[model samples]
Target chain A: AQSVAQPEDQVNVAEGNPLTVKCTYSVSGNPYLFWYVQYPNRGLQFLLKYITGDNLVKGSYGFEAEFNKSQTSFHLKKPSALVSDSALYFCAVGAFGNEKLTFGTGTRLTIIP
Target chain B: NAGVTQTPKFRILKIGQSMTLQCTQDMNHNYMYWYRQDPGMGLKLIYYSVGAGITDKGEVPNGYNVSRSTTEDFPLRLELAAPSQTSVYFCASSYSLGGSGNTIYFGEGSWLTVV
Candidate 1:
């Protein structure tokens, strides 16, 4: 079974500063990793995904993540944080030949102004 | 394209009541999923269907059941409501390219309260 781990329950960062949300995964084979953001009373919105390619993957809203194979980590990062970016984030991992995606508990990001 | 549509945006059920959450997709995708999100918790999959008449249990399927009678509709049934079942439910669908890299689209979400 594929599983994902989000180490932080909540992260606080000042607006205009850099921010990071950590994520790690355990899978049998090559992993297909994804990040999603959810706002209040809304469904999740896909941010980015890492299939197989370059270690660094850029996503929506000036966000990006680095797929570190050795570390089994895919941490979401943004150079500058915005108040509007404060929301709940999730990390998910899936393996080849499986339609199931295992998700992490989640992390709440708060951008302090 | 309307993408994925789920009905009953909000519902309240008494204990022992039964209800079904309807979901439909207009994208012609072959895969659909049902998930529930609790307060401050990650979404937990209840059931998934890869195609018509094919469904499988997911991480949290004990209190829920699902059926896929057609390619576009997958309705989730809760036979008996419990207070613990109160949460926001989301319906999602995706197209599998015979691989693991397809993107999944989600609906706005249906809020349910079991009292």
Candidate 2:
């Protein structure tokens, strides 16, 4: 079964500092990974995804992710963290050709002012 | 496009009472999914439809039912509401991934509480 694991239950970072949310995955074949952010009482918003080629994938709100095939990891990163960037983050993995997505437990990111 | 839209932003139901959560999308997406988000937990798939008239069970389908009567409408029904059923429900849609997979668009969500 395809699954994703987010090691951190929560990540705390100061405003303007770089932020990283670690995600690892296990799948039978090449994985299609995605990161989603959920604000309080709202639905998840897509942050970024790793499909193929280009190890570095850029996404919304200055967020980016690096697909490390050697490590089977796709970690979300931002050059500078904003207080507004604090939210619940989820990592999901789907098979290269399958539509079914398996998601991680989620990590709460807190950006301190 | 309006993407996916969910009705009844919030609802509180008594035990045994049943209600349906309505979802619609204008994206002409071929795939639609229903998911429930619980506190501190990742979203759980309740049911999904590949297209109009084709529906299937997902990870958590018990105590819930879904129908896709039109290509644009997919409504989820909760039978005999229970406190355990209280959670925020989300509707999402995506194009047929074919072999590459596609990004899904989600609605704001519908909050339901069974007391």
lDDT winner among the candidates? Answer: 1
Q: Candidate 2 chain A: worst 10 consecutive residues by lDDT? A: A94-103
Q: What digit string (tens of lDDT, one per residue) describes model 1 on residues A1-113?
A: 77889999999999999999999999999999999999988888899999988999999999999999999999999999999999999998888888887778899999999
lDDT of 1 by residue, B1-115 (tens): 6999998999999999999999999999999999998865688889999999999888899989999999999999999899999999999999983128678888989999998
Candidate 1 displacement at residue B51 in angstroms:
0.4
| Runs off by more than 4 Å, candidate 2 | B98-100
TM-score of chain B of each: 0.96, 0.95
Task: Write one digit per residue (lDDT tens) for candidate 2, span A14-77.
Answer: 9999999999999998888899999988888888888889999999999999999999999999
Evaluate residue B7 in candidate 1 and report its C-alpha lDDT on the 0 to 100 scale. Answer: 89
Q: What digit string (tens of lDDT, one per residue) describes model 2 on residues B1-115?
A: 6789999999999999999999999989899999899877788888989988999998999999999989899999999999999999999988875224588888999999999
Per-residue error for B60 in candidate 1, Å, reads: 1.7
